[model samples]
Target: MIGTEFIAQSPETKPFWEAAGAGRFVLPRCRQCNRTHWYPRGICPHCLSTTIDWQDSPGEGEIYSFAINRMGKEPYVVAYVALTEGPIMLTNVIDADPGALSIGTSVKVTFKPAVTQAPVPLFVVR
Candidate 1:
């Protein structure tokens, strides 16, 4: 496993982190624009609306883009996953051969448990 650290959560992103700890993946949605967004902020990036809601995601996505980090002893995949729910998430692609991945590769969400922090959301080849 890669290095893990406890990340601080704010009031706006508390629900998201808590849900992840409970094994659920959620995204922030703007009630005004009817669009989902990532990074789980309080306001919508699209319409700048403070009216937001949380929606459960299917946790399925496709690799939008990726880079293989070979500087370390083990190579890992860092990728942008285009979620099925209309958002692109910056995340890591785990449990797969780095050389086998390509743009548009199908992925499924999986969690990486942290020491003190909530479980992190990651993806694996599907």
Candidate 2:
């Protein structure tokens, strides 16, 4: 199983982790550029502005790309999910048949406990 060590929980990403712990999905939006970004940062990557703010995400997205990891202790699908709000996130897709996954398949966020700390977000087919 994946662990919290795989995730970087720093001041810059605290809000994201906090929201995930509460079963909510959030993304940072640049107030200046009006764009949403992943891998939360202090400044907008696009505009380099310090006006980023946390916003609740609808948690609905489509698979932008995917690959199955059959060599691991357990098989799992890793994917880039394109959120409805326009940001793409690299995440794991769980609780579904790997063969049934395809590009453009709709998915929604779900939270599961991490090995050492708060819950982390995963995606499920919807």
Candidate 3:
């Protein structure tokens, strides 16, 4: 396990952390553009609209890219998962062999306790 460092939560990202604690994955969507985005911003990246809402994700996605960190204290896989909702998120891929990870591999979200009270979302092979 990596060092449990608390991530500073902001108002815009509070919903995401809340949902993760409840074992659900969520992302911000732009009402105007009907597009989901990562990194929860108050304004939509697509249409630059302030009308954004939180939506539940299917918690499934495909690995868009990945890197195996062999030099770290503990070997782990870091990846960008392309959510079915159209947003790609940078997250850790866990519970699988790092040697076998590949682009387009199916994965699902799994929440694990973090150093802070809130849980963090990680991905596992489906």
Candidate 4:
């Protein structure tokens, strides 16, 4: 994660990462539009409203898609977890047999530290 250093998150998202560092999965919800989104932004993507709130995710999801990255700098699993709340997040999948991966396997969020000590949320089969 050197050159790929974590993008400095917006102030709107700082608390999300802080809570993640503390091992909680928080997501943004726009009450006005009644939709949930990730990577916390100042405005709601659905309705373009400033009305947003954060809630703890159940941390449960199913793999919407994935790839066994065998030829990259280091072999890894990259996947889109379709969060139970409706947002799909791109994150790493850890601690599972890549060969056994499937499109709809259940997963739960886990935290791993980035270079800056902010925890990056990943997932593992549950």
The candidate that achieves the highest TM-score relative to the unseen native structure: 1
lDDT of 1 by residue, 26-94 (tens): 888999999998877878999999999999988998999899999989899889899999888778898
Backbone clashes (count) for model 4: 0
Q: How many backbone clashes does candidate 1 have?
A: 0
Is 3 or 4 the stronger prediction by TM-score?
3
Residue 35 in candidate 4, Cα distance off native in Å = 1.6
Q: Whole-model Cα lDDT per candidate?
A: 0.86, 0.86, 0.83, 0.82
| Candidate 4: regions farther than 4 A off | 1-7, 72-74
Flag regions of model 1 displaced more than 4 Å.
1-8
Weakest lDDT window of 10 consecutive positions for candidate 4: 1-10
Give each model a TM-score: 0.92, 0.92, 0.91, 0.89
lDDT string for model 2 (1-126, tens) is 342225688888888888888888889999999899987899999999999899999899999999899998879888888999988888889998999999999999888787776788888999
Tell me the tens digit of each residue's lDDT in model 4 across 7-118: 3577888878778878898898998987999658989989999989888887899999988888867678888889999999888788999889999999998877777667
Poorest stretch of ten by lDDT in candidate 3: 1-10
Tens-digit lDDT track of model 3 for 1-126: 432123348888888788878888788999998989887879999989999999998789999998888897879987888889888888889989998889999999888887756788888999
Error of 3 at 60 (Å): 0.7
Cα TM-score of candidate 4: 0.89
Ranking by lDDT: 2, 1, 3, 4
lDDT of 1: 0.86
Stretches of candidate 3 off by over 4 Å are 1-7
